[model samples]
Target: MNGIEEEDPIVFEISVVVPRRNLKLENEGFDCVEVLVNEFRNVGFFVDRVLGLHDEFIKLAAPLETLGVVAARLHMKKTTHIGVDLPFEWEEIEAFMRQPDGSLFSWCERFQCYRHLIHFFLIEKNSDVTLKFDGIEIQWEPGEALLQRLELEGIVKQVFPLHDETKRNKLLRSWALNWWDLISQPIDEIYVYYGTKIAVYFAFLGMYTRWMIFPAAFGLILHFVDFGSLKLLVFPAFFISIVLWAVLFFQFWKRKNSALSARWHLNFSVGTSHGYKLSGREWNCLQAPVELVKGSGIDKTKEKEDLQRYEWFGYLRRFRNDVIVILSIICLQLPFELDYAHLYEVIESDIMKFGLTAVYLLVIQYFTKIGGVRSLFYAVIYWWVFYHALLHRNLMILRQVLIQRLIFYEKQEKARGRFDWKDTICYQGGEKST
Candidate 1:
């Protein structure tokens, strides 16, 4: 026997044990063992059996030091241990395990060791056990090790970076100037993209105005005729008027204003450097600058003043022009609707109306030359009247109808039930009393 020697590999069954009385292990619902086994597998450990013990001391003693040795060797990663039964102090377990320089690997190793000790303690207390991390057992406990590991995770060093306000403002200014340039291009260019929308708006306004005038005149006629049946006509006319009003209101409030604001903001944000290039047609048709047109010999001061004046006048002219359109539409529609003479007496009434509108348009073009405060005021009044009378009126009518409907429904319901009149009404000697 002394002449020969036999050699075999050392086989050790690494058992992670937890105690039955360990509340953290119990509250974790046997999943802690699985978690531990999986963690071991992650770090290249081959787990044998996850066991639970009835005695805490036996559970704590079994392979408690061995787990630390395995963790040190394997270099495990740190993970948060959170459960109902975990002590509040264990919240910083990771932080407690962290190295002075806040390295994560050190914390992970320490956390793993703590986890192993808990596993051992839990298995000793409880018979129930789960296999995790290559079929290794896990347990739960409380200690400074977990907290140290948590701090090492650097969760408290949260930060948020924000843009500098001054830089942001400068960018916004550039964007706004660019947007203004984009929108203030020639009508021909605007027509290319938004012509259909504008045409639709115009068509809707024309139809809406006709509907509005028809009802107002019809209502006046009915009022003069003093016919009870004509009162029904008033209701329909009023309803139609209300609907037209809503359409106009929606155009101005919800559609047009919103569109303008969105366009403005878009242009401003994108800056002029990126704006669309002018077409050949636009370049050819472009008017000379007011300074050049005035023949004010390129003196810097005079040029600046002329440009400022031109800008002011341009705004005034545009306002007056829009007002003229509004006035023409109103004037033409009102007279036609009134019809003081035979409705079809004139063969060219429609043509004449159109001609008169054209004349007004020509007049507006001429007055654009004599720009002043008067033009500005006229424009403001024209827009305000048209917007409020036609657009806002329709909005109000819709609101009234909705409110009335609700009121009507409530009254109908109340009339149907939910009230007792027995005590208030009485009949005596065939005579009814309220």
Candidate 2:
């Protein structure tokens, strides 16, 4: 909420004032109340039109919208910010997460609150809302009735600054327990058990943290240790272990993703209303009709094939552009390399080697995002895997892994004929899906 106090609450059609005066913090009510109201309206609009699902169903799609909002804030614009107080009782949060009769409405309502928090932090200037890490640092801080509650119950253990080694072995129930309980339920029925995607997302994060941290430990060990002549035994063994662990982790994920999809009924089949047809959502026009073109002498099958070919060729074109872009970059840098090597005898700075390389790779990634640069996007990924991996550039590696997952899932959908070429690119953006 954009907190501002004023006698005339209505500044714009989308901004409303909520009056609040607590403790010494006497001021205006939030201004952006209407903005979030509109955001939910937008969510409703998509659910009603595109998702073709009900309100309870909106709980599931809302996470996707929330994620899409975060993506937009990250990539496109940071125009809106809102915050809502979340005061969840530990027992209630647990009961909602665990009990058969828990209210999903309450749980999802909290998630929407969290989503607003995400939007607030998306604006770089407003990122100070969190107490770093597990929220333990502020556990002893006195609570105030006026400000938003930062306490998150059930997700974290009772965090205190001083560690009691004596109680190290003592077990405490965790917020993670809530997610685990959801996971332990029949995967298919998890939807009925908990209508919140945060549980699944957190569960995946737990698994991913373990998987990623284990490899990083090995990397750190390699960093600190001097293997000397026995290096032969160390490097190869670490590499093989990482690769083996990665394969096992991903294989497990493949099954997990499949199980969830199946439970959610996303298996695409003709006339199937449930599976790969969650909302029967297509990349289609929701606005003006796309008028059919007058026929040429082309056969229908040939026309379809041509359409598909042209659609997928964007990848090929992207690759070509990536090559051209990289060549141009190298051509510009060739003079510097030569000068560093001979002419001016200037040694290449570390900034040029690592920092500038990251910038170039980022440019490639950005280009890939801009509709015409898919090939360069992929090229950047491949280069990261090869060279960045060699340098142990974990950040770039992480980005590539996430991007590849999206690409992989997209390809899977395409392969299953979730939508034909006509429904893919030819569809309208429709109200901008804004």
Reference-based lDDT, residue 271, model 2: 22
Predicted candidate 1: what Cα RMSD to the true structure? 31.2
Whole-model lDDT, model 2: 0.38
Q: Compute the lDDT of residue 345 as modeled in candidate 2.
A: 19
Q: How far does residue 391 in candidate 2 sit from its true spot (Å)?
A: 17
Per-residue lDDT for 1-434 in model 2, tens only? 12211222111111111222122212212212222234445442222211223211111123323433433333321111122222233222222122223322323333343444322332123223222222222221223211122223222212112222222222123232455553233322344334436446645665687678789998998999998966745765565465456546866777776766543423232222322211122212222111221234545675566556645776898999878888744443333223222311122454444433444345334533443435545443443234334444566544644464455546656866856765665465543554
lDDT of each candidate versus the true structure: 0.38, 0.38
Q: Number of clashing residue pairs in every model?
A: 49, 11
lDDT of 2 at 409: 43
